[model samples]
Target: MNWKIWKKKNDHKKKKTKTREWVDAIVFAVVAATIIRVFFIEAYTIPSGSMEKSLLIGDFLFVSKVNYGARIPMTPLAFPFAHHTMPLTGTKAYWDGIQWKYHRLPGLSEIKRNDVVVFNLPVGDTVALENQEPSYYNLIRQSDWKTVNSQYTITSRPVDKRENIIKRCIGIPGDVVSMKSGIMSINGKIDPLKNTGQMPYKIKLTTGNVNFEVFSNLGFKVSEMQQLDGETYLANATSEMIQKLKPLDFVKSVELYVESPSTNDGDLFPLDPKRKWNVDNFGPVKIPAKGWTVKIDSNTMPLYYRAIRTYEGNKVEQKAGAWYINDKVATNYTFKMNYYWMMGDNRHNSTDSRYWGFVPEDHVVGKALFIWMSFDSEGSFLHKIRWGRLFRGIH
Candidate 1:
């Protein structure tokens, strides 16, 4: 063979066009950003006052996936940036045809109590597209199932596609959690994290001519305080704020508003007549952990039926006064996954585990790191940005 023949047929390569170069750069950027979001860290914005004070509405923070491990997407096929629904189009952003098993990467540390976490709403599996705020279950509970179904378009979401909510993990796996008089107790002891949270207090003032400025100075928002009547008001305040308020002469008394256990809050978790648990007085229920077993009985069925039948994917039924799971006459259940109890720092205002029950392990997203930016919507133009909260580490 001639030596010239061995030479490259085309040594001169064609240069990329300006349009081609821009397209290539855009594609690379999207892929890199998606990878970073999926396996590293992701940005989240606080949309509600549920986590007030600890995490206020308009607070933008970064959630660290590596802290509690990043979950591999169960619904792998989806639009790059959109979550669940596509923007403007009002259509699905994901294809659930190719669903994958839940899997998580190795994490730096296991989730701990009081660690602020982002998790998928456990009750968000089924949703009425028209009314999603109260949740589909709540809608049915509020009215008849037929009425809800006839009025709104009903849809079901996979574990990963459900709505994401941020809250403090108050009860870890196997912890017996309960709330008495709005005071949460873990394993019969008062919650150590209670001080970090705030609740609605009935404030009896000496005069109706309240100095709203004084309360505002103690970090109370005008919107957060409601005047019930003359000389009485309901205010959401923290323990520290309550301490400071006690010294003020105008404050006759500031009493914590605890719901009586006897009062049947129709919206309470489990929704069982036997369990009259309310937000202020909830379970001594044990959180399910992987490999943990519990005796299946009438007493426990109401509390755990959802976990076994819904979250864990088991066919459960009761016949002849005996329980059957997956067509087997079973008297006990060994959980396949761990579960957690999450509650907002804004204890009285939040619809959390007290309303929906345990958050399964697969629902966990990540730990909130810090506030990168916080916006005050009602602030004056010059003071709009909450400068003090910028880059503040979340406790």
Candidate 2:
């Protein structure tokens, strides 16, 4: 064998054009990033003030898939990095032609109570392309299905491709959850997260013309404060903020704004006029766990109907005063998947499980770990970065 000639030939074969090298490097980077995002961890941002005070609107968080198990992508054919829609084009980013059944890779732990969790929006199966803020169902409730359908472009999304939402898990499987006067009680015990959560408060001032700057210094956004009367204003604030404003000289009284249990403003979960469940006062309804069986009746149907029919994928119908699931008379129902009750830390401002009902286990995405970066849009150029919130662990 000619050793020198053989070595030179091999070396020449190994050498690549600049364009080929760049293409190989780019492909490798994209594959590596996608794997890490799907199986390990991914970045998320607080787009709304729903988790205010605990997790701010500008905080960028690294949600951990290992904490509650990484949910296998149901819609596997997707553009890398884009969530639901393509950037600039505003077109569908994922192909729903191929979908896998719900499966999760084993993780360090199951989702626990009070854990900040990210999950697919349960009611987000249908969405209005033009106006997505109120949700498709909510828009229908406000007007009617016919009106909303005519008003905007409507589309249905698969389980994983639906909008991703982050909230605190108030009730885990088999837990009884309720609320009274804007305070939540889980299993008949008051929620401990209430102390850290924010709600609307009626703040009365001693003088009609008081400086709003004082409230701003106390971390209350001026836009969130609404004047109710001459000397009274309604503001969304945390318990800590309420405490700080109480002893102020110009303050008359700072009281929590609790809605009356009797108030039937409608636009709640179940949407039953008879139930009269408001945001401030609702149920002792139990969160369904896997294999949990319950007798199906007219009363219980209102609560679990959506879960059984939609989340669990059953063909449910009522005929001749008899309940039928999958065309079979169903006097009793057994849940196939565990359900969770999720609520925002900004209790008053959030649209959560209180409105849409239970979130199935399959919708679970990841657990929020910490804020890797925080930017304040309301701050000045030099103070735009929230330095203290950077690298802060999420509760």
Candidate 3:
């Protein structure tokens, strides 16, 4: 045997073996990450100020799947890291080749009211193509919906594939929830508002220079301010700040700028013209729990219609003043899944349960545990890190 020839062959084999080992390691890492994400916990970023002071923009969170029980993957064939779409490519990251039915792994506790939660956006079922000015829904409402539908690919996504949104659960299963003049009451009791709950206030200023520092010092985000006249201005404010501003020397009078119920918005859930429920003054509607039965009629239809048809996955219809569930003539319908009412802590600015109705149990992702990191996009380098917010527990 030639020792030199044997040495060359041995060295070549070692190189190939090393390459295969590297590939194996990479595959293993990806698989482990996917499992942890689907069953344990996942990272999320606050993309908007919907939750505002409670959960701010630029705050990064570690959501715990174990809080409300980890939802079994309804859309399991997705890309390893991506949730819905591939980055940059703007294509569906998940494959519909295999989809599992709704199931949840047991968790430490049930979802309680006021828990900051992450779930799929129920109304994001449709989206527009390129060249929409403001929003896809806004563009659809401008003119004939049929024309807009023709141009865009309207996709009805599964419970899990829809966009992920985080909000505070204001009303849980079996709770009667309502908002009265921007104040939330649940089950006939004034549900204590979160520290960050906010609404718009119309302020009448006396003959004096407006103090911007006073609003900031009093802990108001002060989203927008428009001077209507020399003395009056409309601005957004937190509940506490609104009270604080009312007694201020510069402020003559302060009142909530409530939206009229008659003013119809296309974005409201149920999309019914008869129900004059506005964001500021919305329902005393009951949240549906599993096995709960309710009598159905014209009055109740608008409330639970979407819950039965879309959320619970049933075909409901009304004929000759009678209600039917799944093609069966019936007076009452039983809910198949637990439903929640979620609202942004920043009440005035949030697109939440007030607009889109209940969030189905299957759509529940996790409880927001902590803000691991925080950044301020609008702040300079020294001010970028929100020092007080880092590693803070989400209330």
Q: All models: lDDT? A: 0.86, 0.87, 0.80
Q: Could you give candidate 2's per-residue lDDT for residues 260-323 as a string of tens digits?
A: 9899758787766668988899997999999999899878887888888768878777778888
Clashing pairs in 1: none
Stretches of model 1 off by over 4 angstroms after superposition: 1-7, 127-155
TM-score of 2: 0.91
Global Cα lDDT for candidate 2: 0.87
Off by over 4 Å in 2: 1-14, 127-155
**Residue-level lDDT tens digits of model 3 in 39-62:** 999999999988977888999999
Q: Tell me the deviation in Å of residue 14 in model 2.
A: 5.5
Residue 351 Cα positional deviation in candidate 2, in Å, after optimal superposition: 0.4
| Candidate scoring better on lDDT of 1 and 3 | 1
lDDT (Cα, tens digit) per residue for candidate 1, span 1-395: 68877778675567889999999999999999999999899999999988877888889999999998999999999999898999999899999999999999999999999999999988746867774555678664553211133567766888898888999999999999988888889999998446657898899999988778999898887775788888888988889988999889898988987788787797777777767878788788899999999999878877788888778888777778888888999999999999999999998889898888889989999999999999999889999999999999998
| Per-model TM-score on C-alpha atoms | 0.92, 0.91, 0.86
User: Between 2 and 3, whose TM-score is larger?
Assistant: 2
- Residue 307 in candidate 2, Cα distance off native in Å: 0.8
